[model samples]
Target: DAGVTQSPTHLIKTRGQHVTLRCSPISGHKSVSWYQQVLGQGPQFIFQYYEKEERGRGNFPDRFSARQFPNYSSELNVNALLLGDSALYLCASSFSERPPYFGPGTRLTVL
Candidate 1:
């Protein structure tokens, strides 16, 4: 099966702008996904969604939001972007509560 894939591998935006990152999980290994990552630190749990429902969220601000599609793909949307938002946004897929399979991250840079 194909591995998780993310779109717009690299992105650049300005402060106060909004951005969206997309991810497609591996086939047949759906039902759950979590997203988070930085350049230097370990992965941070941003959000978890299963069956198109949001199951968990991390300490991120309201400007950050995400949703899973019926196809099990997901999108992370960030509004009012800040330089602090510049980082590698990762997506992972898993079954039930199992550990996730991470995707190549989408790098976002806020100018």
Candidate 2:
């Protein structure tokens, strides 16, 4: 079986722009989560959705949002991108609340 998958392996944007990152979970998975990894730092949990509903959220601002689909794939949208927002966006999936399998992540660079 395949692990989680993400799209647009890399992206470049300017400050104040908006961006959307995508993810597809492994087969039979129903929960998806998003994380932000800044250089030299561990991934910071951003959101977790189960059964297409939001179950948890992190300390990020309202500019960050996400949604899980019926098929369990998910998308993370960030508005008003900032230089500080440049990071690797990772997606993880699991059957339940247990540890999740993470995707390679979408690297975003803000100028």
Candidate 3:
């Protein structure tokens, strides 16, 4: 009964590079979502996947994308990374649209 898990706890990349983040949901969960948290600010929703389909997305640009697996795991990808992309990427999972349990997050640093 894990909450949520994200890999590569931290990452470093240069501007214009691409990075991928991974997430595994809790047992019995069917929905997974991604969020970005800049230092000193609240997390901003990025994407929501339910049953391996996208259910919602935030105001992020096309550089941000994500997909969920049949097993309820998910991956978040960012293209053309910018210094502004440095943030904590969080993964959340739940049974429905309600509040979801979040993972520790992957810290992305764009140099």
Q: TM-scores of the models, in the given order?
A: 0.94, 0.98, 0.97
lDDT of each: 0.86, 0.95, 0.96
| Selected candidate, larger lDDT, 1 vs 2 | 2
Instruction: Kindly report which residue stretches of model 1 are placed more than 4 angstroms away from their true locations once superposed.
Output: none
Q: Which digits, one per residue and each the tens of the lDDT, describe model 1 over residues 6-49?
A: 88899999999999999998887665555566678888889988
TM-score of 3: 0.97
Q: Between the candidate structures 1 and 3, which one is better when assessed by TM-score?
A: 3
Model 2 segments more than 4 A misplaced: none
Q: What is the lDDT of residue 1 in candidate 3?
A: 64
What tens digits encode model 2's per-residue C-alpha lDDT throughout 65-94?
A: 999888889999999999999999999999
Q: Which stretches of candidate 3 lie over 4 Å from their true place?
A: none
Q: How does candidate 3 score on lDDT?
A: 0.96
